[model samples]
Target: MTKAANFIWYELMTPDPAGAASFYGAVVGWTIAAHNDAAVGGVDYRMIVRGDGGNAGGVLALGADMLAGGARPGWLGYLEVADVDAAIDAIKADGGAVQMPATDLPVGRIAMVSDPQGAHFYIMDPIPPEDAVPGEGGVFSVTEAQHVRWNELATSDPDAAIAFYKKHFGWGQEGEMDMGPLGAYRFLQRGDVMIGAVMPLMEGYPVPVWNFYLGVDDIDRARAAVTANGGTITSEPMEIPGGEYAMNAIDPQGAPIGFVGPRKS
Candidate 1:
């Protein structure tokens, strides 16, 4: 089993790139730029980042081919894998589905996969000589900006999901936290690092889904900024059991996302 590195980038394939970029830029104070080139198969790509050129990410033009194939507008997280081919094989062996076979990128190899329970994520082998810079205005931040600090999988079978991931990614369980009416929260760890958690979706909630946590210094300010832009608040800022605060919001295109910070004691 190979040790997984931190999340490096996040990408979105949406039907309307311009609209999606505008919504995220206004909501998150990102500077959106368009990239058009004959390289990368001659596709039109767009980049989004904070004004400071930190916390950068990307969006792809959700063209007719993608739409015809049933790709919806949503956020996809990219995890650093030691070997892209091995990761894809492990994913398939663990009951996951490979949406896209491994493809080589300028940086490294990448593949999009859905876990056994239907949660989607990406695996990438970073271009060895061209490692991603932390906090470099990208979706997956490390040092300069807050990268994805946490990920949560809301699934019907938490134990099964845990077991599958443990076998596939060498992740270990870190006990469970009480979520009151929401039941217990199961934490997953890799090596000495806590990567994310797994939990049963609240009763009557939607099907299993993956949630990414974006770090922020001030929850209120972030929430306010979200609304001031074209985004809408789906949930008010609330403290979880362990003293962390979070809130949900929809990007201008109605794709949902979350923000978190230290809870006030």
Candidate 2:
């Protein structure tokens, strides 16, 4: 079984997949490959491939039906689990809501869910090949410079949110940082690896949600590429504790994303 609580996949659901793909390709230097889902009787999807030919994530075009049903443009992360159905049940029992029930797909059984504080994520039990081994290919490595590097949660109740996820995914608090008025930023770990953090929503953040950061080689250049490619840089690049820098951005379609990298200077 895949390791539980490891984020195995990332996806972007957008009204303009072609445009979003183009914009991201320029900003993050990813190569987009089109994948038709006709075999699965679903809409066309895309694979965001890294330079090494490994897939970083996917781009899914939202249909009119989905938009009419209130599905907006956004990015979602899929966390691997041992049992999707059992995970869904555990989430519900912990005051969380089931957005989509566990359903079988070509890749795995998946369930869309939200925590008690409304932070959304996916629980997936991925199908394995006969010769496949656990902990291979599906997840990005911490050393990978161009894949997803960090995940941040902006929630209504950081304490409750952390507890809800910990109960289901076995996440532990590694350590925390005081953000002064924004309260404490609690870092989360899966086993020994620090996967991300959960913190109270800041003043300007719209809602409780998970924000993913894509690692880049140069924060300054990536920030420029975002605006040059019709994306908006919401926050200018700022230095973090490790001497790395990060910036927040909004794609032309309005989906929020973040970039982290080493400063060229």
Whole-model lDDT per candidate: 0.71, 0.82
Clashing pairs in 2: none
Give TM-scores for every candidate, taking all chains together and pairing residue i with residue i.
0.83, 0.94
Query: Clashes in each model (backbone N, CA, C under 3 Å)?
Result: 6, 0
Leading candidate by lDDT? 2
Evaluate model 2: give its TM-score.
Answer: 0.94
On residues 1-265, what C-alpha lDDT tens digit does candidate 1 reach at each position? 5453555777766777777766665445565566543334556666666666654556777778877888777778777777788878778887888988898876568899988888888888766445546423245432222445567888988989988877766788888988888888998786676767899976534667778766666677777778877778888988865676878887766567877776433
Model 1 pairs whose backbones collide: 54-137, 55-137, 55-138, 56-137, 56-138, 56-139
Q: Which candidate should be chosen as best, given TM-score against the real structure?
A: 2
Cα lDDT, model 2, residue 173: 85
Worst 10 residues of 1 by lDDT: 135-144
Worst lDDT run of 10 residues, candidate 2, spans 33-42
Stretches off by above 4 angstroms in model 1 are 36-39, 128-146, 203-206, 241-244, 262-265
Q: Give residue 157's error in model 1 in angstroms.
A: 1.5
